[model samples]
Target chain A: AQSVTQLDSHVSVSEGTPVLLRCNYSSSYSPSLFWYVQHPNKGLQLLLKYTSAATLVKGINGFEAEFKKSETSFHLTKPSAHMSDAAEYFCVVIRSPGKLTFGTGTRLTIIP
Target chain B: EAGVAQSPRYKIIEKRQSVAFWCNPISGHATLYWYQQILGQGPKLLIQFQNNGVVDDSQLPKDRFSAERLKGVDSTLKIQPAKLEDSAVYLCASSSGLPGLATNEKLFFGSGTQLSVL
Candidate 1:
């Protein structure tokens, strides 16, 4: 079974500061990974995905993530933090077609 | 295109009571999923349907939870004799029904129904 672990329960950063949310995955085979963000009272939106393509993947809202097989990590990053970026982020791995195993989640708070 | 639509944005019920949530996925989507998101946790897949057929329900508590996706479009999740542990935001998502390995199928999610079991 494929699973993911989010390193931080919560992360705080000042506006204009860089943001990093760490995630590590375990899968027997080369698997697909994803990062999804959920804002307050909103739906979860896809941030980025690594589908065995490029090692570096870019997503919406200036967010990006790097897939490192050697490290078994797909950490999300951004050059700067915005107040609106405050949300709960989830690192996900697909155990199968309909099964999407998710990490506990990491809450990101931007300090203005 | 319109996003996934869910009804009764907020629901509150006493323990052991029955509750149901409705969801309308994006048009033309063939795969629908229901997820339970407990506070401070990521969404957990409860059930998945591929065009009105059950694809996965291993994590679903069949004793109290039930879900259906009739006609391969809309879906409803029902919980009878609910427990306090069942309190969570129920999210409905849909995809194009691509192969399972296609992780980038791009799931469209609903705003979710927040269920509070008192």
Candidate 2:
């Protein structure tokens, strides 16, 4: 069985400040990890993915996540926050090829 | 290059009533999926189809929920005798390439249908 847990349900940050959304996973095998973002009334958009290649992965909109196998963590981060960065973030773990187990999600708020 | 398309952006129904949602995948995409997202929760996979064939539906509520992709291009999901818990966003997603090969492939999603059961 594979599952994902997001540490925070909601996070608020001021503009130009660093942002971090923590996530952890449980999987029997080496899993593929992904980060997705969803805006209000919009569909989910892929931020980045980790497929056992590089531990540190960079994504769109200046976002990135580091895959830590020892700690069973894949935490999303950004050096600076923007108003448009406010959205719901999901951490996904895929043990099998197409089956994805998603976390509860973290709602990020940007304060200008 | 068009993303997944879904219909009935919003729907409202009484308990025990039936409702249906539609989806059209990207051109030549072989896989389609249906997910339910409750408030403050991530989307949960309800069903998956690979070119008109059922690939996985372990999580679907078989008694009250059903789905199909007849021509392998478009799909539909139906819920009967809707419950209060069924009030959520039904998202339709599609991916290209072979089934069970999604590590490299990406799933494109629609805006989703927000269903409200009264």
Candidate 3:
């Protein structure tokens, strides 16, 4: 069985500040991890993915996540936050082909 | 390229009523997926299709939910006698190929249909 846990339900940060959204996973195999963002009234958009190639994966909009096998974590981070980044973030774990197990999600609120 | 397309961006129906949502995958993509997203929750995979063949439907509730992809390009998901718990967003996504070998193929998503059960 595979599962993902997003540590925070909601995170608030002011624009230009550093942003972090924590996630941890449990997978039997070498897992594929992803970060997706969903804006208000919009569908999900892929941010980035880690497939065991590079431990440090860079994604769109200056967002990135590092795969730490020892910690079982793939936490999303950005050097500086922007108001447009405000959205619901989902941490996803895929243990097999075409089967994705998603975390509950963390709502990011950007304060101006 | 045109992205995944879905129909009926919003719908409201009474309990026990039936509703259907449509999806068109990206051009030449072989895999399609349907996911259910409740308020404040992540999207849950309900079904997966590889072209016209079913890849996985283990999480789909056959008693009230059914889906099909015709011609291996377009798909539809139907919910019969919907329950209050069925009120949520139905998202459709398509990928180019299997993972690992095609790990870079990110899922292209549709706008999704928001279903509201009264």
Compared with the true structure, what per-residue lDDT tens digits does model 1 show for residues A1-112?
7889999999999999999999999999988898999998889999988898899999999999999999999999999999999999999997777568889999999999
Task: Identify the runs in model 1 with alpha carbons over 4 angstroms from their true place.
Answer: B99-101
lDDT tens string, model 3, B17-83? 9999999999999999999999988999999999899989999999999999989999999999899
True contacts kept of 1: 0.70
Best DockQ among the predictions, by candidate number: 1
True lDDT of residue A6, candidate 1? 100
Worst 10 residues of 2 chain B by lDDT: B97-106
Each candidate's interface RMSD: 1.8, 1.7, 2.3
Error at A74, model 3, angstroms: 0.6
Question: What range of 10 consecutive residues in model 1 chain B has the weakest lDDT sum?
Answer: B97-106
Considering DockQ, where higher is better, how would the candidates rank from best to worst?
1, 2, 3
lDDT of 2 by residue, B1-118 (tens): 7888999999999999999999998899888999999998999999989899998899999999999999989999999989999999999988885854657567788999999999
Q: Given the true complex, what DockQ would model 3 score?
A: 0.57
Candidate 3 residue-wise lDDT at B15: 98
Give the CAPRI rating of model 3. Answer: medium
